[model samples]
Target: MEITRSRDFTAERAWGAKDIANMNGITTRLHWTDQPYRWHVNDGEEVFVVLDGQVEMRYRSPEGERSQLLEVGDIFFASVGTEHIACPIGEARVLVVEKEGSV
Candidate 1:
């Protein structure tokens, strides 16, 4: 099957599949009032762009700690092996994007 690129919500791609082209990023959504998300650390960098609603991104490291609220048009980055958590506040919706081999 062939898949076209999209600019709205994350396009549903075949699980465990890779885009044959340059994998700049993969977009996905975090539903309203969802649980704290767990993501695998990737070899390439990753980011989450807030397409809609509000979200809280919390991250912690042995050297420091950080937490912030993100709204529409907001973007976030996850470092290598950086374990973190995310919570949507008040009917939140977000688009998660990750680079191939980067998380």
Candidate 2:
């Protein structure tokens, strides 16, 4: 079996990730970031979990643009074609689950 301590993980670049698992066409990853990710819509659904620090999640919907603050232990779900971005408050670790090869 494999084990990981999310708090101890780090990366040299923003949004750097360590692969955790892959099943079927899905991937689970641990990501470390200190910068913001670009706004884009995933081809499939996405599950985002904040493992450490804080993140401001921004998204655009039919109404307009909106944002939410995600703290440790918080989760954010994005359905297919949902435009969104994640901006770290400082240094943060995030767990991401999505389709394999998705950005």
Across residues 15-95, which tens digit of lDDT does each residue of candidate 2 receive? 999999999989999999999999999999999999999999999999999999999999999999999999999999999
Query: What shift in Å separates residue 57 of candidate 2 from its native position after superposition?
Result: 0.2
lDDT to native, each model: 0.57, 0.98
**Which pairs of residues collide in candidate 1?**
42-103, 43-101, 44-101, 44-102
Best by TM-score: 2
Local lDDT at 88 for model 1: 66
TM-score for candidate 1, please give it.
0.57
After superposition on all CA atoms, what RMSD does each candidate show versus the true structure?
5.9, 0.5
Q: Model 2: how far is 31 from its true place, Å?
A: 0.1
RMSD of 2: 0.5
**Number of the predicted model whose lDDT against the real structure is largest:** 2
